[model samples]
Target: MPAHIGRPVIRLAAHRVTTDALLDHIAATCRDADDPTKPHPRLGLWKRLIRNTGVEQRYWTRPLQEATAPSSVGHRAGVAFGDALDLAESAARDALDVAGLDPGDVDAIVTSHTTSWTVPGMDVHLIERLGLRPTVTRIGLSTLACVGGAQSLVHALWHTLARPGARVLVVVAETLSTIYHESETTPQSMMYRALFGDSAGAAVVTGLTDETSADLPTGFVALDPLELVMPNSRDRYWGTIDDEGLHFDSTRKAAAAATDAVPYITDWLGKRRPEWAIVHPGGPRIIDDVVTSIGLAEKAGRYSHASLAENGNLGGTAVLDVLARTHDDPPAPGSPGALIAFGPGFTAAGVYGAWI
Candidate 1:
């Protein structure tokens, strides 16, 4: 826990989505009957209930029906392991290009996303592709859902500091185009089916010593970075495979349970300025309720709206994507911004900063 301070220089970053393909799936398969206004009486109640939540658009790796596992594995995994990494690599390369650095320059790696699985995970494969130093360390996280990217960045920042002149890579890939549940009977299944989307994002966080800081443009400066762990054990949010198909447990209680921790959040944020909060866009009511209790009435809502409109619930990468969009266009070397996210176990990660 370095007493959070200074801005982080982001050397590179990129994002990807299967846009044309995803729009086709939504138009053809989701069905007009799901539209509440154009309900098909014969199509039954649930089938005709439309979700025109203004996300008239979203990207996916492939159509839902096409995202399937091999014959031996049986059924669709939504987005398979290899496909997800393929996208992740594309994103990583793009970021590296922006940074004007090669893979060998990277000293550490942090990979995020909870919607899909990789055996050795994305970090291992990326390390091989980029020819990173053999000593490069890796951090692989799961179950953080949309908040994971910022969390991963925080992890990278810590490692980079321990060894001066080190550059850490943060990669987030989510094919929520995959968190599927064959059985659409339960509220949980229906909620996820209509919400999750696929997308990948990556960035490089490089260290800036006094000499280096003078030569670089100041980027989003970091405030205090904090991670709160829940003492009580609970598996409220997770994914599964069952008779109902590849189901999600975006359990009904996730938000309510998260609300129970509001007191802790306010006191925590009080250490700095809650007026500059960058809250995750969990959903409409989720953000609203959380902010209401935490007293971030004016500040906590900026990222939530943008996150929903641009990419939907990106699972683990939402925070990073929104930060890129919200920070000043030509951010000075010394600008300040706050970063925060929430996830399963009701844990939270927060960081504050200034540009360069």
Candidate 2:
């Protein structure tokens, strides 16, 4: 009946790059190169998706090619890997500062991103740059999509459970607009915008003397991990890069698959009797499907809708954004809450955690 779990502690919370700046840059640079009569590439989008995506704004690491790492926007897409590194590192540092913990204190580092990959990835790079302990563990997630945070937390929990007093750092960097392909308007492409935005989130989670998250120090939020291995008949979500930048695929069947999950989530929630629902604000439809299916339309719906309206879908950062919003000031210790998220691989992950 108690939801307290995980090596609970949110030592610090940090973010970098204003979402508005990224969105504005995206709008200014969206060139419709294929617009026939107009001969203007900026006018090509079939509809004004920037507004429709419900993204208040997003973050970007300069024009992928235009920033530090030289890039040929016409031939190759996005800023050079080095440029992305700069942004990611800065965000991570901000998190460290807020945490009031030195890089030396972190025993592990976890990073999540969808737009770009690094030769060493952000985790190793951060460890080297921040001068963390040589033996620090690093977990990098690129496949989980919107569920990246939950997945990373699951791994963090395991790491902490195995060892005590060890701290873990989480960094989620999303530069969605960088992958925009100007040449496409397929349904898949259109729908993706409704679920992506550029942003970064970082926090510290660690092991302590206590068993439950409610015992975490001030400024920490915790949730339980309800690991779900939902393998479907086929790929429910996927992404690709082409002349149009990056395109995402979310089949109608995926939306339909939502129906199949209701029973499972219903049984899961019924057992816990969650007080607050931190469902991934994946978008209007994903939120609707889950809540309606589980019959938490009124309770979880409030937080899900709030996250969607305020920040669009921030890939790995979506669930954390929800957690950040729902946290109380005089934080109620042991208050029950549910964390649920879905992503590619037709995967579903949920956790139950109580506030400290």
Candidate 3:
């Protein structure tokens, strides 16, 4: 299909929580209450994991006390949904402003999230809250994990391609911290606790026929979006819902899986190498592996590193956060850029875009 997607304009909204504060909170809460002789078994490992996450701070939807408190799944779900709605609305409004459009102008809405689940989903709430047309086409993607943001844009691109002149708003909002609990001390849980945060991002995508097309805006024009799901890799990384709440499990080989998939991605990209790369900051290891596997220059991972260090992982919104950073200090005009994100199903979603 022709490149009908317009420049994607994004807005990121985050909560407040520094890495130091969160670590301290964890240490305090995880201490053994009955046995002074036995410190938390994972204390040492937690410290190391937090330090290695390349994260200095991250935001949360709930206050520190509430987030760290032991809460039921029901309670957490309620809080997360409320917070997501507010953040999503704010992000969508800002993105619309940047695109110089109004809610009524949007023909479709694609919402992506992984932190919370709701019956009507975020799409319905967003429409009611943002005053968007009730008849607007809506797509709600709750699963896709970290790749949700990029996938939402890809879906928006298809929407615009199918219906010329359609204005699609893509919103990815995640409040991962709301699910954190001090009681869960598994290594994987600790790693997630240290690395995940609450954030929401929105982007506007439309069709453009030429560089001078009236629909073109001061944003990155998406092109050649692609997605790949590794075969038989569904068990590599996934989440489960238990009585306590949602639990994420990833084998130590998660990064290796991503690295191994790079060659296939390169083959898919053919000869196109983006000058700028906006990759999901899956972590320090995954970022390094991607840079090496794709043969991208080390500098190409700068934005991804900065996003990881500053905001940790925003789950579904991480890629959009990186994209927003590029918007503030964009690459050379017309420079090709790559947007990539990884998630459950051991999937990789990518797109090649050019700065407008």
By lDDT: ranked, best first: 3, 2, 1
Name the best candidate (by TM-score): 3
Model 3, 1-356: lDDT tens digits are 33433333343344578888888887777876677556676688888988888999887777788777877888777888788788888888888887788889999999997876798889999999899999999999988879998899888888878886678898988877865767788878888888888878888887665542664645677777888898888867788776667778778777588787787778877888777788899898788777766667777788889989988898888988888787778889888877888998888888787887
Q: State residue 311's C-alpha deviation in candidate 3, in Å.
A: 0.9
TM-score of every candidate relative to the true structure: 0.78, 0.77, 0.93
Q: List lDDT for all candidates, in order.
A: 0.59, 0.60, 0.80
RMSD of each: 5.1, 5.2, 2.1
Cα deviation of 141 in candidate 3 (Å)?
0.9
Scored by Cα lDDT, where does model 1 land? 0.59
Candidate 3 at residue 208, lDDT? 65
The regions of model 3 sitting more than 4 angstroms off are 1-15, 32-34, 210-212
Model 2, residue 14: C-alpha shift (Å): 15
**Order of candidates by TM-score, top first?**
3, 1, 2
Model 3 compared with the native: what TM-score?
Answer: 0.93
> Quick one: RMSD of model 1?
5.1
Prediction 2 global C-alpha lDDT:
0.60
Work out candidate 3's RMSD over C-alphas.
Answer: 2.1
Candidate 1 lDDT over 228-298, as tens digits, reads 76667356676566542445675556757557666666676675543444566666666666656655674
